[model samples]
Target: ESLNKLMKNLYSTHPHFVRCIIPNEFKQPGEVDAHLVLHQLQCNGVLEGIRICRKGFPNRLVHSEFKQ
Candidate 1:
């Protein structure tokens, strides 16, 4: 019960800390759905097992990769 309440609170508070609201027109629903699926796959380590790999990095962290 306590864990459930904490999760509920986290979800409720998340939008307040969100930095930007991207326009839906600029982001296709299919593409966004695919990204969410990819992130889940990455978290589960499924991506590592695939023959073809895509380098995954958050937008801010991407700049650091280029600097090296």
Candidate 2:
């Protein structure tokens, strides 16, 4: 069946996740609700992950090094 093929393909690949957070209910540009954004990041563990990465690698990479 199609579902079986889909599951087989998914299991064979490395999946990456992208999380999109809404800044505000009004959907206005150049206007972000700090509290809402903070709540979303905290709930999603994004802040904690960033903190861990910073602690592990405190060195700042140059643009060329980063590009490589």
Candidate 3:
């Protein structure tokens, strides 16, 4: 109850939403699915949010190590 109240207060004062998308479900190393990524982005409205915000940049990285 206290945690929920804290979260509500935080959002009321400064709203923020985070959505994460995994590339694939096989847990393979060094694998990326462009279609899945794009679909997730679309579904999450990230691309639309970017256009709406128009002040931040999208970030991605290629990790050197991803042990699976």
Q: Which prediction has more favorable TM-score, 1 or 3? A: 3
> In model 2, which runs have C-alpha deviations exceeding 4 angstroms?
1-15, 57-68
For each candidate, the alpha-carbon lDDT, in order, equals 0.53, 0.83, 0.75
- lDDT per residue as tens, model 3, 27-68: 577898888889999999988987866766533334653221
Lowest-sum lDDT 10-residue window in model 2: 57-66
lDDT of 1 by residue, 1-68 (tens): 99999979976762312123332435765445556566666766665645344454312336766555
The collision pairs in model 3 are: none
| Candidate 2 residue-wise lDDT, 14-57, digit = tens | 55457899988798998999999999999999888789888884
Of the two candidates 2 and 3, the one with more favorable TM-score, higher being better, is: 2
In model 1, where do residues sit more than 4 Å from their true spots? 1-32, 52-68
Number of clashes recorded per candidate: 0, 0, 0
lDDT of 3 at 11: 59
